[model samples]
Target chain A: MTKFEIRGLRADVLIGAEERQEILKGVDLTINSGETHAIMGPNGSGKSTLAYAIAGHPKYEITDGEVLLDGENVLEMSVDERARAGLFLAMQYPVEVPGVSMSNFLRSAVTAVRGEAPKLRAFSKELQQAMGGLSIDPAFAARGVNEGFSGGEKKRHEILQLELLKPKVAILDETDSGLDVDALKVVSEGINRARATGEVGVMLITHYTRILQYVRPDRVHVFAHGQVAESGGPELADVLESEGYERFVKAGASQ
Target chain B: MASPNLGITEHSHGAGEIPISKLDTHGSFDVNDFPVPNGREEEWRFTPLRRLRGLHDGRDIADGVVKVDVQAPAEVSVETVARDDARLGTSFLPTDRVSALAYQAFTEATVVTVPADTTAAEPVFVRITGVRQGDAYGHVLVHVRRHAAATVVLEYSGTAVYADNVEFVVDDGARLDVVSLQDWERDAVQVSHQYTRVGRDARFRSFVVTLGGDLVRLSPKVGYTGPGGDAELHGLYFTGAGQHHEHRSLIDHNVSNTRSRVEYKGALSGEDAHAVWIGDVIIGEGTQGTDSYEHNRNLVLTDGTRVDSVPNLEIFTGEVEGAGHASASGRLDDIHLFYLQSRGIPADEARRLVIRGFFADLINRIEVPELRERIMAEVEEKLALHE
Candidate 1:
């Protein structure tokens, strides 16, 4: 089992050349392996900021915080180091990388993360199997990574990476936003398959409770004003679904 | 400025409002017809005149012979003829100062011919080595006769200041594939003009790869003599520190139902590394059903490097099928770098992968397998120098 903790995570984003705006303020969270946590928040609630800050995105400056992955200082590691340490961030908007085919990118990623390059025959079989599970076209293996992919196709590719890389802790940021009903089911199934291995922790961040219906979360945290307003079991998600985030926004304003 | 010299008559067509640029009417075979460029003309604006080693001016006249060695299949014919040979300049004329100077200075010319109704089983390799004894002038003519097919590779190496004009004459129903490689020594300077004439229903494909040299300028021009002719020009250049490599291509659609496509990609690294690509496509009046497009893309790998990419499209006829041009030069996309690094690839390896991918689309189009591999290896070597 692996324990990941973020304590007093205060961060700022550079809005201009010399301007900095504080986004995450004194946010705290802990996630353990094999447990899925649903971080529910409205717009500008610092959900994506928290995800990027933990993933070592250069855009976010961690002013005051400590992120510990199994008691190791995760903040000191570089972006690739964070990735090599078994942390993956499924970006809300994955950028298109032209000319680098999906097969080449996946092989490089797997080799870097796993410390050794997999045999070509074995890796091809594994990729074909994973892509089949997600219903992705086999031809995508030769096409440039995420180049000219539709909204739904891009989201599915993100999940495909998640299934192939097999990180210990995955922060899926808005993976189900642009997906259709059928794509959502396929993606959720892939997430569940990763979770079934009992070696990965899922931090599913979303504004809607629709995806929670498919992949049940062990914990639900209502994130507001860069802090957790309330925390509870799976029932909390249903409560938020019915009541909406109006109460949490008002409570955060008052605080 | 010169009244649209090729095909369009001024004020005679409805599309006569477009201004005629001086470059459209510049052509001559006499060295004295063209003035010495002071680096201000449109053709000489991006070039470094001082680095030319007098190839641009008359100081570097041809005094030493640049050895020309031709290797071809037994069926192909190779001949060395005097400057007065009738077939030397039958299909080409000097268009610029350097070309005119080289045309007036060379003592002999090398002509490689593929006879009519025959297909050469192997590519003809013309390897030119600079003697470095004195400035050199050279000329080569590649003739693909009627109903024939051939492939030619022109390889340049060694050190000296050299200027040459190469002509390609493709007859009716013939096809010619040519790859001109400028892999010179570190201190070499070369100015080359390659003019091609395609006959009725003929096809021409040319690849110009510039990888080494202190200063190298190449102008490749193509004109169709009859309808249904097609031409494709593809080029790749990697400019290292203090190196200047430029490619200018002009495609003149003088007849109807002709087609042309030009694509050039470049990468520059190190301080003072400069690359320039100029693509000019003109669809003349009455040349209906003309299809042409040119594109240029440059990848800047380091700071202090410069790239100038200019694409010009001039169409005097509104009846053409299509005509377009595009140019772009910039550093590698940071998001692409981040995307790769976020996947656990190291920063250096990520850069290598992105650069490799940037050139893969063009390199894969090269039909020669060995040359393609060598170009990739050379690209990797340049990337390593940057790192």
Candidate 2:
């Protein structure tokens, strides 16, 4: 059964401004439970916007489409409601909130998503275990969320949240953008751990296949001009890796 | 300066009546007793002097007796002290100083003293209420005696279009945790002067939260009297529509080896809601090994909101270890708001969280649990007003 389904999705960018343009037009995709799907795209391909739209960002108006999480229309829900509906987005640039401790933010987010307060002792033990598994310093739990953290540290924090919240559908948006080799490995391993739950569906959005080598997506789709241009097995990542989306660009132009 | 009508009315001074003539007085000074030299007056620049034009005109004191509610711990008693008492000192300008004489003349002045070397288990709450017409001048003399540590919360809540002055003296080795809440009626214009003296090795932590009144000015002046004295002044002010909130703080390190830190954060919303933060730190000539820092930050919540921050550091002797100041005035960062909203928190909730987080450092510094909770409630109410 489909865990998330998007039908006839159409999104526009800067509708009233000079850069007014249609980014996602008539796109259709579906992800089943316990499956990892990667979306590879060139620059300006609306990969990030799609992730934001699915996460119900207020700026990204759903002009014409229906995003159903577990067959429930997500467009009708608020951003936080969508989050409570088990939808998680690993941001490209995680915002830094000074004076808001990491533990507090995570606790609030986790309780919000779970719709109930987590037992303190159990939550603390679980959080400590998760931090250790991700190789994150325990001291970071007390520090402000993403404040002055390195790029890798931020990505790891996002994964840590995902593991703790246990969202049904996790959208990884450019999680590998600024990570070093070691960071990429750690982040990919964290994702793998989250995937090991075998109940949550993963939508991995990236431009590079380096991270895919570790997480190993079940399916890979090439996104161009706001729509998925091609789809295949994991080998599709290697083809794009060698050729660098030149063929996809030409094909997108013809279409 | 003494007003002819300066006497205890129906309100009791705890003790019997004391005439104003008995008080130590400062002789007549110029109309501008405190000079604000052209641009050199950092605290005077942002104030709208035009609004203060007729402030000196003597107005009639409110006719009826004003009832002030005092909420204190069971052991700590509170009663109005005589305005002419010498223990309060000559720090505050007498009620007869200009337009506010009438209000200051009638209201009873309250003094809350924590005895020497005695520690109060709970915070003492002093709520001053001004009703009816005329100016109101009430002086609060807090003598946290030697080695005595206590928390006092002074809240100005009333309906009076007048001025109020509060003075506090923290004695040697005494620690005073003061939280002032200003929530007056819309028709009221409040001009409050707060003076604090930190004795040798004494510690004074003050948190001022301003959220009401059409125009409110809070000038908190702190002086380190002896060596090793320290003070921390943290303030949070929120200005809604058609409101003007001004906060000025001065940290005077008179003795050597003293330290002072002042951080004031303000958020202005609505049309023509103006807020100002002026922080000045002066390290005296022989104040060697002194460390002084001041920071003023303002967050404009709307396009029509205006904020002015002036952080001044005057160091005479360069023998100090560190002396610096910082000021920032900016709008609510969209990126920061969006980040919080993305985490399933609604836009309004996110804004409240961000603003609350801005003052969290100062709030956490408050040692009094009851005062902290009350301040948090006030902050929540202020944020809800924006919605």
Candidate 3:
């Protein structure tokens, strides 16, 4: 089984001209294969910071942290190397790539990850099946990636990547934000399918517990003030959903 | 225009509100008749006169050697006749001193002619290889007769101080495509003029690809002998350090119900890389139904590179179709690069993909698949140098 460990992860937002703001202040987390860990937090709680830090975003500088994938220091690896090492991040806001068709981009990504280009017919069939499962139009295979796509379409694209890349560890940040009830179910079902593979460890970052009804998490963590303030099982999510984060906010404030 | 009215009486109207000037673009082909350029004339302002290898200042050198090879289908005819051949100057006269001098110096002219009412399934090929550094004058003529269709490819290579004139006379109902590829050696200098005359209902398409030479300037002019003619000019170029590539085109809407479109894309990298493109369209008096649009976009891939783009349209009649022009030059899109890199693509590969995609739209328009693949491969090779 795969293991992803984030220890004492203190990171900061990189501002212009050597300026930085500490965002994730000494956060710690651990996720293992075949498990879903949902990160629920308020705005400005640095939940996304932890996800970006683990994914090695250029804007998020890990001031004091070590992210390990199977004991390999991910902080020392290049972005692509980290990906090749089985780490994936479903960005809250995916960047648009013009003139690159979806098929070409996914094929290239598959080639890079697999170290060999897949056979054309098999890859095409796989892509068509995956896209069909997501209810994506077949015509999107030829369109520019994320160009002119709606917010929900962009989110669906992210889940599609998560399914195709099949990383050992996936950090999904706010993937359910823009999705409607139907899309949320579709996306959560996709996540469940990946988990069914028993090879993916999911770190699902969300503000609401709605998606939990579709794909239940093994553990739930309440993040506030740059760290997790409370942890429990699916029952904790029930309490948080009915009661809300005011208690956690007050508790974080007192500290 | 988005579309032209084919049946409209376009030849009876005059040019629109552009001012009348005495500077006409047509004249005799006599060497002494053209004035020596002092960099003050409109035509000579952008050109570096001293770098033209004395072809402009009445200094004609014949020491340089140039070999020309022509390959054509069996039905076509090819001849190297004296410069005084009746068909030599039918399409155009020398409008500039360099063209006049080249016209005066070339002892023989190579002519490739297609018969009337026939089509060549195979493309005619011309390869011009310059062997010496001294100045040389050259002339080429291609005539496609009535109802005939032909595609001509002209490729240049090696080193020389070369000045040449190419004339195209397309007859009524004919269709022609000419692809001029300048894959020259690094030290080559080429200054040439192309004059093309289209007949009634004839169609002409031209593509100019420039990838080499220290300094290269080309002028391709288009005019119609009768109505219902169409012309398209698609150009692509890449300039490296200290290289200069320039193209100036004049499309004279001299007949009615005529259409023209011009699109050129270029990339410049390295220090002192410079490129220039000028598109001039004139809708003269008594010509109506003029449909035209021109677009030029340049990708400035590195620092210290410069580009100049100018589009001039003079219309003497308003009773015509649409006309438009656009120009843009900048570095490759940064968001595209970051997006690709975010997907784990290396920065170099991302840049190459972006460059390839930038030129893909135009390259896809080539009807010949082999030529399209060849050009795309060449573009990839050029990108490797930058890497």
Name the candidate that leads on TM-score.
1
Ranking under TM-score, best-scoring first? 1, 3, 2
User: In candidate 2, how many Å is residue B132 off?
Assistant: 2.0
In candidate 2, how many Å is residue A88 off? 4.8
TM-score (all chains, Cα) for each model = 0.81, 0.67, 0.69
Candidate 3 chain B least-lDDT 10 residues: B1-10
Better structure of 1 and 2 per TM-score: 1
Per-residue lDDT of candidate 2, residues B104-154 (tens digit): 454467777788888888888887776764455555667777888888888
Clashing pairs in 1: none
Candidate 1: deviation at residue A41, Å?
A: 6.3
Evaluated on the second chain alone, the candidates' TM-scores are: 0.93, 0.81, 0.91
TM-score of chain A of each: 0.98, 0.95, 0.97
CAPRI accuracy category, model 3: acceptable
Q: Which ten residues in a row have the lowest lDDT in candidate 2 chain B?
A: B18-27
Top model by lDDT, which number?
1
Pitting candidate 2 against candidate 3, the one with the higher TM-score is: 3
Chain B only: TM-score of model 2: 0.81
The whole-model C-alpha lDDT of candidate 3 against the native structure comes to 0.84
